[model samples]
Target: MPVSRRTFLGGGLAAAAVAVTGTPLLAGCASDKKNSAAVNAAVKLPTYQKYGAIKPDLPGNDAVLDAFLKYPANPVKAITDKPGDGQPISFITNIPGAIPPAADNNQFWQAVNERLGSELQISMASNDEYPDKLATRIAGGDLPDIINIPPTTVQIPGLLKAKAMDLTEQLSGDGVLKYPFLANIPTVYWKGCVFNGAIYGVPVPRGMSRTTLPLYRADLLAAKGIKDPAPKNFEEFLALAQEMTAAKENKWAWTKPPLPYIRQMIGLPNQWKEEGGKFTSFYEAEGSSEALEAGRKMVEAGVVNPDTFSAKASARKQWFNGGIASFDIDSFVAWNQYYADNTAGDAFSVNMLDVPGFDGGQGKPWMGSALNNVTAFSKDSKHSVETLLKIANWMAAPFGTEEYLFRKYGLEGRHYTLNGTDPTPTKTGVVETGIGLQYISDSALALYWAGKPDVPQRQHAIQEKIADRLVYDASYGLYSETLSKDGARLTKQMTDLENEIMSGNKPVSDWAPAVKNWLSSGGEKIRGELQQAFTATSGK
Candidate 1:
């Protein structure tokens, strides 16, 4: 369950203060390791004395609201004639599809360049390769003026040490706050952008996407005479899977991917700590053990196909074509892509199921974090504060506004026509009228929950239902460099172990020593570092 912000802060404040100020405190603490308790007691005294109550400054802005109401024209001038005369500002984005067409370059770039009063250039890279490329560029002292760092790779320690330009002061200031769209962002997300009390990035608000719910074939459930097919607990869920399999009369109960279902099973976030300072894999969490056991039981019972994990996209194809009965899928896939793929008729009727809670374990239901992505400025950018501010303002603007939609979707009549109120494309007019790949980073373009008529309203409905049912994993912070590099490796190892055990190739008895080894080898260190960091910054 989600803890209140106040409760989280109250519990963690001291540890957080220590982590944030630990560099100076480390010297003192280092000398008294022999008397650690005494040192801890001594440290508390000074922390309490020096650190007074720190309240977050919540600034209000009527001007920003006005600007939101009336979005002003682009303030910068076009650099069409002398393309390279002005300060050339480069924007590095992970959205592989965001790049505008070369033919429309003169029109689009001219508009962008004019809006920024700078020679604007846009570049695209794949999300998978972005972190490595970004790291190399930053390390080599080569950086674009505006660089986007997905929350997944925004390593707090590395970014701070690298001297990334701090935008916290600017963003919080009166000038930037005056842009109304900026206020639309939730303050909870600001935590990811804050490192050591300094902000280095302008958060690009991403709406809820990629969250998973039980995407089951409702028609199959009804045919099986199962009412209230949605399971509320792990046991019930497993039973439902069994029932569905039996009702299939030979068809598989569920499709499977290589991805483990434990994270969803126990409502635990993707990461957690066990014994040592090293970060243990989520699979190593107590909840995951229960989840694994559940899976083992299901497999042993023949509720799930032994070949389920080997099933691919073709499995989903078969399921939609009436081969398999039910499976788990993201709400978006079940509604938008699946339905659209079978335009001849409804391939399957679907419904969302609330992720089941563990019976004896944690009561939390697994859900995705609210944040989707973030945008940051390069540490070496020479652009003035005013220019950067303007860029940020432009970024915060909503879709369907003059700035983003017109550039992204093109002129409505000429490029595409609204098939109906729905945002997702339905007809060739909107389909052929290219929107490019702007959806990569643009939240407004990806309408996950907010509804439109022509599009799959079921997807939106399912998302909202899931949101209402599950709590966000507030314990897990955005992924940092240290976490990602280490966590990725650990996750892979753990997943391998799981595969071995689940396939009956290895026994669950091996889990203890394997866990000990994991912790002894750097898992504990990572955990301590993260716990320490979380405590220090969270003001708990």
Candidate 2:
């Protein structure tokens, strides 16, 4: 699991990722399923146009982000003209941290308002509280001009169709080319923004290049004089864990049993496997039994942190920071926290194993769906769709641009200080710019850090190594009523059972019957629904 400025901090990461669609909290609230099903309807999605005003050191490919080892010495404005009328514009979004200083007191917010030539009014809720707020707003028809739709929020494409702008006419195919910055978003990611048969919103993009992985403390390994050979297979990884565990010195090898990583290494399907338009859940896949057995073995090896057996991510991070644990799984986007928090100034290094296959073959690294959320234009607002879109375009200017730099670093001398080319955030900037502003309309997630050039450099190297072997969760952007209604509950059921089996509370053989239970209880229905979506969209 990962936590950071860009990534939501407190949530169930694995289950959320696997769900791909949404949660069940809003099951009691009904909307027209016909609208959600419109995702199956075919239309031209947004086309791709990589921003080239400032070239990146590590160019992006397919799912990889254009990686910048350092910020441009002098950034040019990506958009010169004002995108919107100077009228007040309101946005409702979820925040990863506390609300920033209000517009009256915040210089950063004031500067952004000046740039956009509008009073950018913002309303925020905590990530956990956002769903209820969104649902309430949608039901009451009180949406702001711009609404940030959380990826895991229950899909209400029909409701959105009623309350939000159907952007197909303005954004579909080359229509989005009119907004070059929005066009800069990779094409494949546009599927997430389309709901039913309409482009309901513009996506807030994440990336697969620097995805979630099992990262280890290379500094700790070097301190112990241990060489990192980048494990060839499961066997080698287990051996390395065994060698790294030093219980006598309050150190452990693993933060938790890497079940998902193991399942991926064994060549299991990512959430679902599709063949000839038929879909099968990963629990029923051929190698699932072996993956579970391996997970159990890894847990029983006495190398895992005991605290990690329970859901204690915050506690596990403590162990990692205190050197009580060597390996912890997290996103590369979230990895900067280590260096940012370090006082030792040793540039505490980290590295990953490249996730070798269970049998010493190529391992498939899981690719993220690349959508954080979609920011929709609310019909309730007085602003015109074109006007809102222009404002969004201004907000979404790509990295290395002056607009991007200003939004990110605020006034450099006050909000941030430069460390070489890096605009390191000061305490004021942390309280101001780092607030939930990106939830409005951010450029696709790029690879860059304030002062740590090697961090992104290493991330790019890892992405290149796994480039050919990346496996994406195909369930994303697909219509599934059963999944939308009871997905969180169902995923939690299977995850709980998997944890039980891994912790030895339930025998590994129990997996067979448990999986059978899953199929009869919505899994089959969800599979059928996904199959229909796949067929409708893919024309298989």
Candidate 3:
């Protein structure tokens, strides 16, 4: 299959041929024998040490990320010397939008090399191409020192055992104290990184506060003398969508059907719901059919954007921002990204639609996995694990430290300029810096908007209101061989059926057969295997 370049804004597909949204259901480093969450949580993890050159304005725990309102005036140093050996280090990671300028010509890269005290190299692939590239590299016996494992990739358990270094001794228990930065990473993130009872990778941590939500144009509705169109139920939501859509005026209610939110409103499981010792995939949930019926009706009524099924994520975001759609589904981070992209003349507050209940009562939002990606090391790395660990520790330096300033923003004059207390990235900085490095290893997850002090508080407030209501997948930390073989086909089949039903090519009656096909094609086995794993982990 030909690969396409793609960027990430959080959830959803990386602009693939088919939209495979939501976080992947399997771990990149997993084991068939058992999941590590339960065992590892009881084992000695790194001591939970905390550090920040500057304290957060809005305090947060592991669930909520610490907030920073300004760049430190004089950032303090965390590492006294370079972490890298005097040799070259090569790694691979996904760069969302642009392939950064080459290291030879890239001043930002050169500066990072200077700070690390070694030549650093990266094989940056677009998100869509990463799985293929990684598999090829592993098969060819030409793996980079560091490999960023994306969740969507398959055959990871065997791959990690065969090729990835085991960091159990180096990172487990109090061993992680040697790398203070790594030690600072929350235990929850590390729990997801364990495989087969051993620590194999470091997580790019994510918070559970908010993952994906149905966002709306509050300003647009206000201008039309409308109240916040947070509907009371799915039925009311459809009416509100119809009320908001004016296709002749180049507006639609939303480009994509808010199926995830719909699932939430109708009280479906996060991904799997368990009852009476049986596990059920969201596809087999009670609300699954109802959500599909509602979706078809909306499509039939022309309330959905015509381009929804085919349009790229970027295009959909543009449509939403331009008032071509009054509501759309997006990652929580888009709240800040959209703000950053908006101009003074086009300023508007992006409001989240409360995940309304089916009966017009309270609703629940799904909490995604505690990580986006995990950074793993090659078992055959030329450098010692200790040396690599040191480099990772330096790279994982806390935000507001000098190491973070350099690694994140690059050289002061070249990559960024100070705007008030904000460290504004230069055009080169924006184009060059964010391409990959910060992802190789990250500091503690923080909520910081340099120039915009209010954003942190606002985001915190939103999270506080929603955190307790979030639901999680019962099979979150477990691995599934059945899912690996059959998930893609089944997911695509169901998604295609949805699009077909919505576009009137198929009727709602088609859903039962489609689901039956999914069940026959290993969905039932996946459910059983996940239940066994869940039982093993929960001791239920």
Candidate 4:
């Protein structure tokens, strides 16, 4: 339900924290057969066949992404033959931009379909509309061959169990070996796709700690002769924000509430934190109240956009990129996209802020969901399940391969051209590929940028620097019946209350009554169930 440069906005406040973590209720459900993630993981996962087509400039560990300093000069073919069966494959995707030209008139679509050996018809919707549309389509029994299930989907467990193909036998453990590309994906990412103890989909793998970062216009700051862009401590940060504030010039320090970043800076809990086997929600976590108060202070100080709560989501980026605002918070994935879009005459320096602590100590950031989203198949498809599996396999081809090229850039010469191995998209390619193709089934995380060879290294270095200061949710892989059923409503209540406090309409003390209501309204039940799940997984 979140839209930014990409689907995963990463660090949302309380609403996002609870909403993204909720799952479809599967307690004692026939569809899942009572399998837990631990049980599924115990099964033999597919052998991780490393793709050696193009070696990385920076070698990756499980926690890091493969960083490429330059595009492979001689790209190798990963898929030996066309994997798609000569049948039509229908899918639904959440496009972040305008829908591309229809397949009939689009050469890019035609070329991709020709290579896949199937008619890949994509039914597109905006990110905001995807959840409702998916639910409606599933309930109507008009399921597409493939559907992308983001983490934030409502009633995902039930939707997947009732309508999605149970991939336990096909993709569980060694089952995925049948499809070499899918097998190449790391086993850890598959854990996120598991529902009711069975592998249900393939995930777009991402690093655990790479998510939202406090972004600032380093170029703008440098122009003003500010060498040390980031503040040393929380107090200095406030002073710097006020200094950056220029209301009359219509320039401000931020475009949105900075509570999420501030929470990370003060070492606050990420949604849920554990202490002596009990999980504490963000509203009750240590330092959470202070974070809320900090946001209120910024709002009261007139350092951020006054209309931040009411501004359009798209306007946030426009304000930052146009220099109308000098600071904003965005996902780490936006680094390249922001650079590409914002650079015209004066190539600005868009830097990710290393969050500072209250007393100048290194701030701790919360770990992100290990994946962007999952790609699942329908139980009732026009084509055989095997055919769908092969299509997914082809789509999962790693970066620097021919399949990756077709999916990302479309046909060469027409859609894009190689400028010393960096494929520059033509106007046609940009327009046509706007609809999310790579997202349908992307391979493991890669830090490659053809145009900006140094981007991978820069980002990798930053992540490495902050690696130790990352905290994770205690109930990360656990499912709760209460959360599945009442999470949206509960999270929405907290989100509204938090916004009210930030806008100075209410005081931070009001959070206590909200938490009381949340507990009485199933939050207490969620805590107990999640605790049990944690114990089960940890074998404690």
Candidate 2, residue 507: Cα displacement in angstroms equals 1.4
lDDT of 4 at 378: 84
Lowest summed lDDT across 10 adjacent residues in model 1 is found at 43-52
Better of 2 and 4 by lDDT: 2
Put the candidates in lDDT order, highest first: 2, 4, 3, 1
The better-scoring model by lDDT among 3 and 4 is 4
Q: What's the residue-level lDDT of 509 in candidate 2? A: 92
**For every candidate structure, what is the RMSD over all alpha carbons to the true structure, in angstroms?**
9.8, 4.8, 6.0, 4.6
TM-score on alpha carbons, each prediction: 0.67, 0.90, 0.89, 0.91
Reference-based TM-score, model 1: 0.67
Error of 4 at 134 (Å): 0.8
Stretches off by above 4 angstroms in model 3 are: 1-44, 226-229, 343-348
| Of 1 and 3, the candidate ranking higher by lDDT | 3
- The global Cα lDDT (0 to 1) of model 4 is 0.72
> What digit string (tens of lDDT, one per residue) describes model 4 on residues 1-540?
111111121111111223432443333222243544355335444556776667888886655567887767777777777767898888888888777889988888888888889989898889788777766676567778888877666545556677678777887656788888888887655666666556667666654435677778877877777764667787888888888889999989998878888998888777777666677887777787888999899899999899899889788888888898888887667776677567434557677777788678878776676666778888788777788888888888887787787788777898888888888888888898776776667787677666776568777776776666766665555666467557877888898998899999999999888888989888899888767765665521
lDDT at 182, model 3 = 89
lDDT of the candidates, in the order given: 0.47, 0.74, 0.71, 0.72
Error of 3 at 256 (Å): 1.1
- Scored by lDDT, the top model is 2
